[model samples]
Target: MKLVIGGAYQGKRAYAEGHDSIQKWANGETCPEEEIFSCEGMVDFHLYLRRLLQEGKEQYVREQLIPKLLQENPGIVLVTNELGYGIVPIDPFDRSWRELTGRICTELAEHADEVTRVVCGIPVVLK
Candidate 1:
C-alpha cells in the first residue's frame, strides 16, 4: 500500500491521483466501510476512522483495520490528512479520534511500500 499524508487541502489527493494512475477512487466520507478493501484508492481516510470510532468499533480499529487492508488491498493508495500537527482538541471524542488516527497512520506507514507527505502541494517521500 501507498500512504499519502499532509495537512487538509494540501493537494494530497491530486498528488496521489497524478502519481498512482488509479481509476477507481473511493471517498471515505461516503463510501461503505468495506469498500476500502476493494477500492483502487481512497481519500479522506481519517473520516473513515472517525466513523469507526463513533460507532464504537475500537476493537476493529486496533485489531483488524491494518491487517484487513493489507490482505485485501495491498496496493491501494490512501490519502489522509495528517491530524497530529495542530493543537490538541478539547472534546474527548475529538482527542481520541486524533490520537487513534495518529497511531493507525503510524502503523500504516510502517507497512506501506511508500509514504509521502505533501506540503503546499509538493510531495516529500518519507519512505
Candidate 2:
C-alpha cells in the first residue's frame, strides 16, 4: 500500500503512475494525464509533500485525500521517492525538507503492510 519509490523519473515514475492508473481503470474511470511529481527532482516534490504531512495540515490532507482514495479503490498505493538515500543537499532549506520527508516516508512505511525500495531500475523489498 506504501512504497519508497526511487529512481530516475524516466524509469520509476512510470511504475508509480501506472499503478495509480490501473486502480482507476479497474474502477471504470479513465486515468488522468500523469503529472511528473518529481520535477525540481523527486526530493524537492517529496519535501514539499512532507511539510504538508507534518504541519497541522496532515489532518486536512488525510480527510480530503485519503478517505476519498480508499472509497474509490480497494487499495491505495502511495508513490514517493526515497530521498534519504542520497547525499546531503547544499541548501539549508533543501536539507530540512529532505530530512522531513525522509522521516515521514519512514514512518508511513512502517505502518504499511509492505515497503519497497526502488534503485536505478531495480526494486528491492525491505518489508
lDDT of 1 by residue, 1-127 (tens): 9999999999999999999889999999889989999999999999999999999998899999999899889999999999999999999999999999999999999999999999999999999
Best by TM-score: 1
Clashes of each: 0, 0
**In model 2, what are the clashing residue pairs, if there are any?**
none
lDDT of each: 0.95, 0.50
Clashes of 2: 0
* Per-residue lDDT of candidate 2, residues 6-124 (tens digit): 74462455555543444222110122212222121122336346556445555554455334433443244555666676789998766766776666566656665666666765667
Report per-prediction Cα RMSD to one decimal: 0.6, 7.7
Error of 2 at 70 (Å): 9.5
Question: In model 1, where do residues sit more than 4 Å from their true spots?
Answer: none
